[model samples]
Target: MSHPQIRHELSKIETNLRIEIGQLAERKQIGIDSQGTNLCELIALLTNAALSDHPLFSQLTKLDAAFCQLDIGLYGLCSDCESEIEPERLILDPVEQRCALCAESYAHEHRHELRLTH
Candidate 1:
């Protein structure tokens, strides 16, 4: 996708994440990039560790990693296959980590392992 499109998607995801983080943290932090780090730290401290088994924590961790990938110019690439994820999918969900094929395969293999606990 074009840089502008990427930025649009990123901004959308950032906005959605900011809302969630704002609610989860109970205090909104201003700014992007830097605030992602700060909010992650605050969320982590709130989670009090041992949250890898939790889905929301995992999603936040993955999105935080996505911001790191963006910093390194690898944001939209699949983690398993190293291929560029479909542009539409990325635009729809900028935090997505896998291409369609890899995602399907992963879901097939890991379906039983998927569970969300509150």
Candidate 2:
């Protein structure tokens, strides 16, 4: 995709991520009342688990960093090969910094390294 199109898409994603993060924070801040019934307490516990270490929260953090990179004009370049990332891949995940081949290679190497360490 063109730079402008990429920028526009990333901007939209960034905005949505920020809004989601804000909502999640608000939910966290409204602590469940200790005096509530058992059901309420159970619901609150489930909500807490959903909010904490959730994939959405992690994605928000990643997208925030991606926004920073976009601001500096380095969004679509593959980190490993310094090649332009495919536009389709970018559409699938604007925060992805590496092309498919490079990402697979990196993952493979990382897994191998983990095996060695273990």
Candidate 3:
């Protein structure tokens, strides 16, 4: 279908997915603290990891919004660089906010960057 239609569908999917994840988290917490502290700690760690990655889900939502805008002939316009992104790269990542060159350079600079510091 068209980009606008696809974005609308994606928004619905994202809402459902968020609800499913919430329910799953609730169910996961119902289980008791068996197998000692280590098991409990492990479960907490896993939960933390899941929550940490939740932003990617938000990013997907933003992508859908961008796609909606793109449907009105705004595709390939970089939000960061304010330049036309490559068509080839847009085909690869329709939700991308940066052009290939900018993306690659950013990735190279931040690949080793850590989000959480102890």
Candidate 4:
């Protein structure tokens, strides 16, 4: 994706994350920042509170990482090959850090690990 598109996409992701956090915080009576909260720490707190119906913690972590990568001007680059990630893949999940080639390779390399976790 181009830089402008990526910035727009990240904005949307941020909005969604904020909405989810707001709803979850309201329901749990937890305090959250209006902007710039630490995603991992906030989620950890929510997890400790035993929130149900929340997004998976790992998913939010990926999103938080995406925002950080964008801040560093590396949002659309693959973590492995450093190539630009396919635009379609980014649409499906803006948090993806691997391009198609590396994703397949990584999947093969980590298949056993995934199975164990699952």
Best by lDDT: 4
Ranking of all candidate structures by their lDDT, best first: 4, 1, 2, 3
Top model by TM-score, which number?
1
Q: After superposition, how far is residue 117 of candidate 4 from its true place, in Å?
A: 6.8
lDDT of 3 by residue, 1-118 (tens): 4666646655565555445545555676644232233322433544554653555444544555565566677756776677888877655555667887788878776765654332
lDDT of 2 by residue, 1-118 (tens): 6667767877687666555555655676754332332323433443565754666656655565566667787888887897988888887998887898999999999899999999
In candidate 4, which residue pairs get closer than 3 Å at backbone N, Cα or C atoms, i.e. clash?
none
Candidate 4: residue 40 Cα off by (Å): 5.5
Listed in order, each prediction's TM-score against the native is 0.65, 0.59, 0.48, 0.64
Clashes of 1: 0
TM for candidate 4 is: 0.64
Write the candidate numbers in order of decreasing TM-score.
1, 4, 2, 3
Q: In angstroms, how far off is 23's CA in candidate 4?
A: 3.9
- What's the C-alpha lDDT at position 8 in model 3? 64
Q: Where is model 3 poorest over a 10-residue stretch in terms of lDDT?
A: 31-40
TM match of model 1 to true structure: 0.65
Of the candidates numbered 3 and 4, which has the greater TM-score value?
Answer: 4
By summed lDDT, the worst window of 10 consecutive residues in model 4 runs over: 51-60
Worst 10 residues of 1 by lDDT: 26-35
Each model's RMSD to truth, in Å?
5.3, 9.4, 10.1, 3.8
